[model samples]
Target: MDNRKTPIASFYANLQVFKGYAEKEYLPYTTSAGDVAALDAALDNILEEGIETVFARHDRIASAVRGSAQAYGLELFLDSDRSNTVTAIRIPEEIGALRLQDHLSENYNLLVATSLAQYADVILRIGHMGENAFIDKLIYVLSIIDNGLRDLGFAGNGDLAQLFIDIYKENI
Candidate 1:
């Protein structure tokens, strides 16, 4: 049997060739020039801000999000292995994930992700990554979530936006 002729092996070989081309500033396929320009701009911004500072900002934003979730008496899906970019929160049974997501979208023009499969109705995912990892943007998102939950009859223990701001300030 020629193992190298297998589909997986062929795919790997093609991937290697593509990588080699990329290393030499060549593309064997068509790519969106606008996307490449946008990526270049993003890279330039990150370089100007310093990668470490960008990482620290993400960390601070994540901490604030988690703290605000705790203050709202919401349970985190992953207690320890949580991500620095997205936070998975277990929504209250009465709230309904779709309801919360729709409320935010319809009322505030904000979109939040709902979990998949069996957990879809119970989990809400909030992303605080890249450009979304800023304090002002996070505060607005938290406020919208707080208002949406309140409108939906979920009584949170503390003000979500205020708690997020407090936690963010503490981290800074």
Candidate 2:
């Protein structure tokens, strides 16, 4: 029940895998010519694809977070432009991350993730990378936050939670 610690180590430990050796199919780190060639080929393929995909994913997640944070009444602690898929934003100190994460899981079957040690309670990191980084998914998270905050007596308008697009108006 302690809200002070990050779950990174515990999460992996909970998997309880026997760490005797690396998986059977994987090559060992010691350099064989075949392993070297495999590594080179893999590196070449990744260098060609990873950079482009990473930028694309980062952009999508950042832009989405920028829009939703205000709606959900979250403080933008990190710039979307400078972040990867993992964007950090601040939530109410009153609604601790563990409580919120648990509430989310129990009520909406959602998992809210946090970052490192000290800022774990206040800062929730939204990961918008890999196969599931869809805009709908982000909107769902915001929606969950909206309902959760209201349930916790937050005064912010809950309509913002439903806005999936990043929109702005120009003053005339």
Residue-pair clashes per candidate, as listed? 0, 0
Query: For model 1, how many clashes?
Result: 0
lDDT against true structure, model 1: 0.88
Candidate 1 — which residues are off by over 4 angstroms?
1-17, 23-25
lDDT accuracy of residue 53 in candidate 2? 69
List where candidate 2 sits over 4 angstroms from the true fold.
Answer: 1-26, 29-54, 79-81, 166-172
In candidate 1, position 58 carries an lDDT of: 91
TM-score of 1: 0.87
RMSD of each: 3.9, 10.4
lDDT of 1 at 111: 91
Estimate TM-scores for all models: 0.87, 0.60
For model 2, residues 1-172, the per-residue Cα lDDT tens digits are: 3343655465334333323335665433344889789788767855877877656655766666666676656777765455556667776888876677777789888887976688777777667764346667766777776777677666664455455454322100
- Candidate whose lDDT is highest: 1
Error of 1 at 113 (Å): 0.9
